[model samples]
Target: MLTTILFNPEIEHYDFGPGHAFRGERFASFRRMYQETLAHNPHFQWASHDESATDEELGLWHTQDYINMLRAASLAEDDEDSSVPEFAALFGCGPKTGPSRQSLSVYVSRDNLNPLTGRLPEGIENAARAIVKNSMLAVDYVLQGKTDKAVGLGGGLHHAKANYGEGFCIYNDVVIAARYAMKAYGLERILILDTDAHAGNGTCEAFYNDPGILFIDVHQTGIYPGTGLIEETGAGKGKGFTVNIPLKSGSGDAEYERIFDEIIFPLAREFRPRLIIRNGGSDPHFADNLTGLGLTLAGFWMIGDKVRRLSDELCRGKCVDLICSGYNPDVLAGAWISLIAGLSGIKVELKEPVPRIAADEPAEIADIIYEVRKVIKPYWKCLG
Candidate 1:
């Protein structure tokens, strides 16, 4: 029942720039609020990170060439002589389309390159590597029984791919942590539940053909890096192992809870994974600057409750949470408090100034759920 909250001040350097929506200030804001609100809670303890992920650790999910490319870009100076922009362009640096065979990173973020220097922010690669290491440390904490649950406050980088960064994500920390848990602990099945407002396309791509990992992503469809479809059930040996519940815009707590009850819970019971990874921050809130999903503070609490219940039921309470994506720092702070409270089995009523928005029609939600079940029925007996 103990939980470790991962921390590292250096992760603040992950910011793109002053005007970018995602800023490093989020860490400070959330930390202050978390300490003020929940510092006294006996169930939670803080764990600070001491090192960045090594080349070998990152190599678990990222290619060596891509790693070198990111490292080089991270060190580039803000001058005309710097080829960082060109390197970024070759990889996917700007908003507009890049080369014909460009990676998804091209269309994911408009701020990947510095406007002034056309180079990535210096030391960002270090922050990203630190995040990967923090996430992996959380996994180690849970698997090694140092704590029943742990939260990598800097993780949830689901958009980074094997050979390219995407959606402002420089490394696929979620994937790397999951892979590390399996490889280091000899686990056969691991469950990844991503509830980001945008689809976890990079994470999906990494495990599209691997059956040992079950990745269930519930995302708002038709958003940035749009790729999660109901038909994207894992291919090859991973068929049925991958499940995508692409909800319509404005889908709220009711829809999310039902998806977990009808699909997520059953799948976990059947798969019986040794570990559960809950990824995503608080971007699904109605007031979020980016994306348009509607999840109030209470909704996030419910989602966390479900994840905790499942962990207790199936995995001996071993769960790693990656709270890694909220544009509005204040909202992210509130939502995370509620989520962590639920995960710790603490009763807390969180009040947000913004009211919950109306959800999609029940019929619409039902149809979406039915379609998801039908697509994965071949793999899960609970749905049948």
Candidate 2:
């Protein structure tokens, strides 16, 4: 059975307001798609977050001071105007840094008012903990031979840093789950496959110098928090552990699939990880306003299917997926459904045209991949 973990209640408090581009409706859209798909397919076994993680668990990847700061901000209990100044400086909640009224226009209708007071509710920490806990549960379930693959649809806050939260993310759920897998489950080699529109900067930072974790990110170049250059391989022992493939803005099916075949697959074979984690983000669709990547729904299905096959072949059918970034509700829904179908071994047909190429894709991207292969060739098999 496919174990699927969902933090449905966490979506309620994690709102970025009605007008924000990262609106809550995206989850609703995904839920709709899930229900529709389930009506026809009944292989999935849905599970929710059971026990919230404790402060000690969260401290595995986050600083205690940062956790305290978030807790204090949530307990302020002040008005929106009053709370803005205090939390803004501590948590990057200002108009310049945080989600502003303008960004809301992309997702919500005009004239939407801010519902969140820049402060979380009493159980805010519990909510973040729940996301991490559910992810960990999914991993445990997969590792214990209870399931071959599992997915957490409500986690994958990749942009969150070790000390501070950003990009609508509070805690880096995937990092916490990966850590649990390594320390608690006795998994030596772990692979994180991030196919989001944005880079997995936080995850990269956490395991930058650790050879135990193999991190691979394929995202849009020159995007927000931009640091996933191909040359930024790892430092010291982690030199070849980190692989970044910054794709061109409009790179759709061909470019993405090519990178997977040439780079990701070969590297995974070399690493021979015990478990594989996927950061699945659907914001690269042409319909999404966040980025310019023009991947179709079918394209997403193909990539998801390919990743699933890779995990089954290389990692003994142990894979866990976390939802990352995806804004456009329609695109997010369609792409997520397609991914779920592929993960369940359902065949899909591609009927759409290939996406247009981006104008800003530097010629150096290819060169960067070549250099990365050279650096990591000794560690992984099938690199030649």
Candidate 3:
């Protein structure tokens, strides 16, 4: 398979703090996995590189004022207080329930935990730029017909809004890239498939009424930044285009497969987007402390297969599988590697024992699926 992945070692500079959930080590672990995978699969061909996004490109989705706030946060004030009032307003960073440091910009050391004490590392901008640039690069690869698929290894960062960034996310990368594809690449239909444990609120918000983008997110209900209710379909002409499946906590692989076979597949066939950008977060894995879903590594593999099939059948194999959230180091590493295995058209059945976690009661999962179908049925003829 011809695939392109946008990545760089410096992007790991986008670290929050010592104890934050979105740690820099996550990428380091993935890098280790990448090296091991290449060693094993010598024939596997992938184009990987580092790319940066300019200020103008960021404005594609973010407001100028919001961009300025992030810029200021990237720099520490001379007062040594390190607090930017605007940063708090934008990212909810303040005294309690926020970063340990009062500083707006993070100037961490090589460990990404110690402060460099020189120029505060502008890792947020560096990481956010990678997200946006990789997203766009993935699109470019498909548009140019160089590859049928790509992977921009980063978070969906779906919690960010057009005007502000929040929920461990600095900017909405998927939305900016979708907009880029539409305006620059002349593609009319795009789908944002977010299977994160948390709702893809920012992505849904960006295209709620735009009709051109179909946002279907299946997430654990009542999580942080909760907003993906079944009734919260798109507004105005965008109604029916926005599909949200609010799965109950503890829902597992069986429940996910049911939704895909029943709802997502049908909807995608009807909508027929030119590109599908999947925010493939592994936080739903059973081992993660951050989420309640019990999705196993095998489940992650299935999703990669499903995405590949969708791309091949619907969008001429034009798909980008972005690496999103997953906190547990061991489980996250396995889940992501298996996902890539599936994307490469290889079956994944790990020799290691699968971790066990609670599965949502079958009846409860069924009920939620039924509820989602009921609401989306109004907008789509395939639901029936």
Per-candidate Cα RMSD to the true structure, in Å, reads 4.3, 6.0, 5.3
lDDT of 3 by residue, 178-269 (tens): 88889898999998999888898888888999899889998888887779998989999999888888877778788889988988899999
lDDT (Cα, tens digit) per residue for candidate 1, span 93-119: 554312222232343244565444445
Considering summed lDDT, which 10 consecutive residues are worst modelled in model 2? 104-113
- In order, the Cα lDDT scores of the candidates are 0.83, 0.71, 0.74
User: What does candidate 2's lDDT look like per residue over 268-330, in tens digits?
Assistant: 887899999988678877667788776788788877788788988998788898874677665
**Candidates arranged by lDDT, highest first:** 1, 3, 2
Error of 1 at 64 (Å): 1.1
Name the 10 consecutive residues with the lowest summed lDDT in model 1: 96-105
Candidate 1 vs candidate 2: the TM-score winner is: 1
Better of 1 and 3 by TM-score: 1
CA-RMSD of model 2: 6.0
Q: Backbone clashes per model, in order?
A: 0, 4, 2
If scored against the real structure, what TM-score would every candidate get?
0.92, 0.84, 0.87
Q: Which candidate is the best by TM-score?
A: 1
Q: How close is candidate 2 to the true structure, as a TM-score?
A: 0.84
